[model samples]
Target: MARTGSGTGSGTLLCRRNIKLDSFLKRNTERAVYERIRTYEPCVVISETINKVYMHVVLSDERVYLTEYPPRALTIAFSFRRVRDIELVNDLPDFLSGKDRELCQHIRITYLTEKPAAKGRDWLRRDKREGLPPAAPPSRRNSHSPTIIRTSEGYPAHRVQGEGGTEEVHMLPPTRSASWPNPESLGLLKVPHPPARPPSKPPSLYSLSSSPSISPSPSDQRLNIGESAQVPRRMGSVLSRLLRRDGGSSREERQAELHLYAVSRTSRLYLHLQSSWNSYIIRSTLSLDPLYRRRCSVLSDSTPDKRLPSISLERTAHLFGQLSAELLQEEISVESLYLLLQELRTAAHRNVALRRLFWRSSEVCVFLVQTLEESLHGCQSLSGGYTADQLLLSTLIVQTLAVMFRETEVEAARHILLSAKKGALASRMLLALICDPELQTENQGSLADCELQALLADYLDAACSLLFEMLLLGQEASRCSPAENCVSIGWILRVIQPHPHLLDFLSYQAQHVVLVLSDLQESCLSPAQCVLLFQRCRLLLACLQYNSQLAQHLRSHFREEFRYSVKLSCAEEKLPLQYPISQPTLRLVEQILTLHRKLHTNTRALTSEKGL
Candidate 1:
């Protein structure tokens, strides 16, 4: 019996050991298999790693998507049944190419077909699912014990373990998205930082127990960048459509619309510029850029070949078209025209090389002149309402002309005086006012018409008078070279012959006398070469036969000078005189007196030799 007992004991011990060893081996084998299976399971790549795959387990997603299939939620459950121990997910991905490996590391997929369990709507609530066990009912707890608020739920909704561990706190966020009040109405909101520790005394409702709420200050608040400005915009209706591309707009199909948009924008810019009158707008609003300049240069009959497809100036003929369209309306203002001239003058002054610009550049001068000419012409015409713009422009243009042409260095005054073959408009306006006793002959504003004379007379006289101070002023005023002066003077003299009554055009009574005297004086101012001046003046004076009284008055006025001139002529001839000194030039006054005395005595002899 002792022997059998010993044998039984050994068997029993051995069986126990065997059972334990089997359990151990099974556990090890299972762990090894789990590790291997984990390699094949789907995972996500949290970051790039040489030989590792890190992923976040997405439990569920409520976001709706417009697509064929609902996205599968991922979980951390894994198994390693197929192979021995494996360390990381990426190490096994060596068999995969770049994209496959990326896919393997960046996606979550379940290997098993079993669907994931879904949580109920109370998933976010703490009371039923995440809270501690409920406190004992009143019957179960003694009233004396502190009222422990134990909840029947499983675990605490929020718990802090250590620095590395945290728990979620459930509370309302200050701003609940778009439903929140406007940041502006709230006024300069300030965010308060949380205290280091909660107050010993529980905070009042006003005191903050939780993290401080953050509110951006007024300045820091986001601006609605693309919203309409405070002043409501007057949007042009989209009666037209334009092509769009890549969440933007396209101009290809909407050519007309695009052009319209451009025109509107440009027109608006012009109006804005006009209204604001800012220098920056003036400088950059319209570029003296090629387009504007070319538009200015466009001519009515411009040829396509000669036209630059896009240049800054226009052909001279088309200048009228290119002016700021706003200015072309029924009533152009004096202020506007003055401003325009300022712009032109500014451009000319600023550009030193304007001549190279050719035809268009010349148009600047032509444009200005024509505008002034037309405006005045218009104001004087029967049709125009006689706006003062023309008169104002005239004033400005005259001043501009003086400034612009003063540098020419040419002495054109003499040429001007001599070229009065019907006279320039400026000259005519002056003369018509002077001679027309009623002056109502037509189209003459006494104000504008008469002012021209005062300006020219004063201007010429002042210039000549200044020369007198310089000691170069001659009694008659002709320092001009005969060569050039003759061209203009000959015309003046010739015009008078064909148009005998041209003298009526002189602006002042004194102008006529001055004209005659001027001719004589210029001849004397430059004696030798201008000798023809005297001859011309003499012939012109002789043409005043119908105005004999006026002619005789002139002769009497220069009587002493005339007497000396004739006597000297006769002396030079050294000839005996047959008649009196007053007959004509080249006659001696002395001979006239002597002949009168002799005629008185000889009258008795034969009723006077003169009577014969």
Candidate 2:
């Protein structure tokens, strides 16, 4: 009995071991099969956990696969060829109930008229070298000998004479084959056949010679000839299909579209997640703790990196589209609009390409004009309807426009601004903002909050800078057209007449001009800095030419500073100046001083006559 019991126990253990071994082998075989399949096919795998549910998504060239784990185990696959549309669902569907409905974010895919099953794994293996037939061996024939064979339809054919006097003939189709010249006419030698064992490296399409060759038979001698003939056809078909699949768009365009889609989706996800977290905190005990709130605020207010974030051209276009769409809506979120404008301002300031794109967008230009009009109306209202947020938003808009105009070519900027529907209205609104008594430098000290005062000052600076560009454009336009000169100059004169503070502000900006000119004389400056200084000088010259009183004010109050700046600018270079750029700047400064003196003298003479 003991012996029988031992034998039975040993058998049981053996059976268990066999079963475990079989299972292990099966798992490894499955893994190896999957890895082999993935080797030949390019795919993107994304692992995400949404609403406590883990999901895996696989994207292949032709199809999409989605798998959900655990309690809600589901797997779905669909081909891109069958997809009619893909929609991003922000709100919960009716079928999703309870917790699922509240937390789920899903993609809704619509299928075409006939939805077919996705292609098998073998489809991806088509490009593999192992799937291709081996190349045939070349026939043993005299180098000078040529044999011509004809098909039943009388079309010309090529014949390869093999060993044992067995001849194989390849018929050339009459229509397309005529384009290929006879091998003998080209004076080409026969290609050597591949060896019995296939080469480790795959054959390249370009390796095939242009001469006509025989098709392969069941025998190995003709294999290479067949492969060379078929490779070009197969490659051509593959490329055509890829081009068609992309719907005539280039690869770069498709990539840009995908990038924009990914960015928008990620932004939505982040916003949703942040909102959910905030709501959870509000419902929990953390909301009531002042210390926690303060800590959160401190973290939020921590200094960010000073370097600007890198942005692509596609992202800038996407931002412009979003802003235009939002502005077109009847009701827009102030915070969201401000954030978008802030991002655009940063992008425009950092990227010259983005600035040009921004200026070229006529829709954006019109929308900006409309926004300025609304802000102007609010500011001019009797009820004091312009809020701090509106002021900030306007400042961001002006700053972005100022950067665009400053960096872009003057003619392009002028043309774009004038082409907009309400272009002139923008200038009027800008003047109103710049001339607002509440935002004047003199009134800045009355504000208790220094930050608010600083913000107003920045807004004033941007407004003044943009207005100056517009005035330059108007001056050029005046030289060309008498009517435009009358309109632009008349409106500017009318606006300036009502607000003498505008002249004071111009005088204040002249201080910066003095400092920049003095710095230019003391040390070498970059070409860009020199250009900026030249622009400032031109603006000062225009101010002097336009108003004799302002020139008199400068001569009386700031005469010594002006004289010193002019003297420093005229002195021979201590440090070498960037030629051409700095030379023009120096010449402009001399012109400005000459004009200032002439205007100041004329004003004094006119004042003496008035006293008499």
Candidate 3:
């Protein structure tokens, strides 16, 4: 009978006073229900009653508890699962006293009942006593029609007293007369009447008879049963047809076609990039920068005053539309489009400012994924199934998923994979890329070698970047609780655990980064491509040294590579880049290498201590 404080430990106790009673009881009831039902927590507490004050408690999770307190405390529980219906009664009959009437705000709950008669009985039986009655001839005018039976109050009977060589026939819509049918007369047993419909709704067309408890008039009987049945059928057919028409039965197919067209459209424009330089406008006039590149690639939304550009799916579509028209008149390079897409993909992956822009305009990401999926599938099929284009697109999808996952949007990430029917398709591409031999590409000539190695490197870089993001997400969990950290770290481990080759590939990529950085000293890369390669290397080195799981595995699986990374991390100098690197890029590389050294030193010390 004693009630404690609010379940939230808020110190407030529920009061029974009239002024606060209803709200108090409602809130407490909701708390109680939520505590009871953990899996399917109640969505909302729709209605509650406390008129009798101790009569009942309704909680949001569809449980009702009746309680009595003070004198003899008792509790009874009922769930919504057994309930047939709930009705709110606001009116009181004239016979009720004022106080009783005022307390009539209680709800009426009905539970489903098991009716015995409904399951076990054959309600009607035909009497069989043969060879006794003599036949009576029918009258001339009524010979073709069946005999009609009527009782005194104009109710119809199933049969009348008539002489004939009798035969029993079961009939439809058995008549109910002034009195219920008896076993002696027709071998009929009593059955309970069906529940009546609420008076507010119009009569149902599918109900057993058109009129209720009354025989149809002569004129009404003239309308045939077929006509009545067809009325409802026709109405249903029309409604279904309208729904199908409005929803467009070919919606999915049409969407695929549109997505394909968009990809094809972009492809045509991009192919113009490889064309003769004189065919188009020069690069100086265009804003060819990847949007928010530096801000997004780094983990900082550090600048409060910076305004990140807002790009939506609709805006991207509109831009494509305008540009496509311009491509007809003058040459526009595909690099601009690629840079925007790259920026968009980056923005979707990192820092809150760009992420907010992405979430505000989600459809653009959706369309981008769809276009990529369709385009990648087409490229795979046309190129006999393992093209650079296909592998690149698959990596883009994984990159997009990583971004969504980083934002803690697991469902959004799942949807993008499933939505295009490319969930398995992307997996196949990744698997093929992994298992495909590198032996053939080496012999294909320098042009082919550079192209294939670059593509493979990009793919590996993307995979490593996703792993880094996953570890970053785990780091974010430290702000919450130890349990959250376990879950976050566990998720990262589980994801990478399946792809052991991913770890192997990252190990290879780390070594390749060392080579690429050495190559950057001699070979000139476009600024954008150069920036991307540096970022990839930084991410690879950072993830290898910092992520406990990856770092542990790397040290075991690729010991020599791990030792080299440690040496690079510990060395008190920078690997010089002869091909003048930008100040920002140089600074980022130094920061990453410094971080790697610090993390590696700490981890090595921890390992030695653990061993001791």
Candidate 4:
């Protein structure tokens, strides 16, 4: 019996050892599996806790994962692409304890999802059939305890830990270094060495010498030099201490530090304001107003033009499209953007002389038009009364289109007009405003009509001024080599000729051309050249006499104007009143005189025919 008992005991001991070995192998296998899976699905550990804690924070390229390992592991991954906002709240007082006390810090992340989970509803239901014990109700004692709050798929929710929690913290592998000291301790106790005792002064044999002397001595006088220098040093030291609590720093350095702090504070405030504005824009774009609407008006009371309001500039950008995109992206402010537009508009108005005004106005208008088009494209679902900025944009578009038409960019004007909501009406209004005053002689105009006329005239003057430059170039070219086949005069003549149905905008410009020629005859051209030019001018006059108004204007004013110019050139040359002209020029002059007489006679006959 003793032998049997001994064998059975040995077998029982073996069985116990085998059971323990199996358990140890199983635990090791579970750990190895975890490491293998993590290696395959690579992720960077941002932070971790090693006290058998349930929560883990991991960062991947596109998402941040927060995993809870309560009995079983479950993860909630938030993609950065869907993350709308991220905020770090530090030193938050424990709020649920019915007291305003700072308790801990937390990271608050707001993200968007296509299918959001229903609020206040648990994802998991308790299975009583599994025979699991019910979770204890949370109380004040366990408010911040490492207890499972909720469970999903048999895994517990993350336990909220505090800064004072007894958990071993670890940083990401890339950021970790063995050389770095642990930062878990709240305070460090620096061991101090004992101070050495000062030697006792020998019983003063000269008590009088130890006492401070009031009388001036040679040695004391020498020390005064050192003491005088030390006075300023003390004052400087005190001033430096007042400015900076540590080492001596100059006033400039102190000021620079202050300025740096101010700049940093300003930048932080700006970022916060921008984030809030972005949230507002997102809501506005969606036409969902959970909060009260923000009614920001960008109008300035000190605007120079009463007809147009100044847009407050809140951002700087190279292009309006870029500015608009920045505004949508919360990278720039509306005030800066609008202020730039206003300044450009003011400059354009000031320079209404055609060349400068044309380029400036075109630049401003094109920018405004592009911005408006983009805004319209993004405004499909939005519905609300237009803001001041929106109205300002609309007004700018209208003004720009008006300027385009007045400057004879009719095709561009038509294209832009067609893209607007009330394009036809705008086109008609612009046309009426720019129509020749000669065509509206009897009617007294309204204020808007008068304003329109002024705008049109300014634009026309700019257009006509461009023609002046062309004429000046032609005159210069002609003078350089009059014998060369000059096509400039021919081109201008062809372009300026009046047509019955088409409106003539170049009548005034043609008169201006004659004036330019007269100026050229006096200053830039020789007597022979002037006579040659005069001959060409006379021929041009005859061809243009088909128009009764041009014919009458030339006969009454311009013919005399050229004649006086030619006579002045003769006087300047100190020549006889009648000089022998070249055969070609002389023949041209004679033909012009003949044509003038014939045209006048035909005019009389035509008038009589009409009367009959």
Candidate 2: residue pairs that collide? 135-223, 135-224, 136-223, 136-224, 137-221
lDDT of 1 at 233: 26
List, in order, the clash count of every candidate structure.
25, 5, 1, 13
User: Candidates' TM-scores?
Assistant: 0.21, 0.40, 0.32, 0.20
What are the per-model C-alpha RMSD values against the true structure? 47.4, 30.5, 32.3, 37.8
Q: Give the per-residue lDDT of model 1 (tens digit) for 128-180.
A: 64432221122111211211122233211221110011112221133543222
Candidate 2: stretches off by over 4 Å: 1-319, 349-363, 370-391, 406-423, 436-448, 484-497, 514-535, 547-584, 604-612
| Tens digits of lDDT, candidate 4, 1-612 | 000112321221111122332232233222211111110111111111211133444222122333333111112233333444444434322222232223222333444433222234222213323322222222223222232233434433332121111112222123543222121211111222233232244211111111011122222222222122121222323222221331233222100000000011101211222222222222222222211111212122233122121111111112333423433444345576655444433332221122122333334444444555444223422332223344344344443433233212111222223223423332222222221322232233967446545554444443332333233223222322223313233333333443331134434433433544444434443333333243334434534543555555555554554445433333333322223222223334445445556666776798999999
What does candidate 3 score on TM? 0.32
Candidate 1: segments with Cα more than 4 A from true spot = 1-334, 342-361, 381-389, 410-487, 492-612
Predicted model with the maximum lDDT:
2
- Better candidate number, 2 or 4, judged by lDDT: 2
Question: lDDT for every model?
Answer: 0.26, 0.39, 0.33, 0.30
Identify the superior model by TM-score, candidate 3 or candidate 4: 3
Worst 10 residues of 2 by lDDT: 253-262
Pick out the ten consecutive residues of candidate 1 with the lowest summed lDDT: 254-263
Candidate 3 lDDT (Cα, 0 to 1):
0.33
Assess the local accuracy of residue 308 in candidate 2 as a C-alpha lDDT between 0 and 100.
Answer: 19
Top model number, TM-score? 2
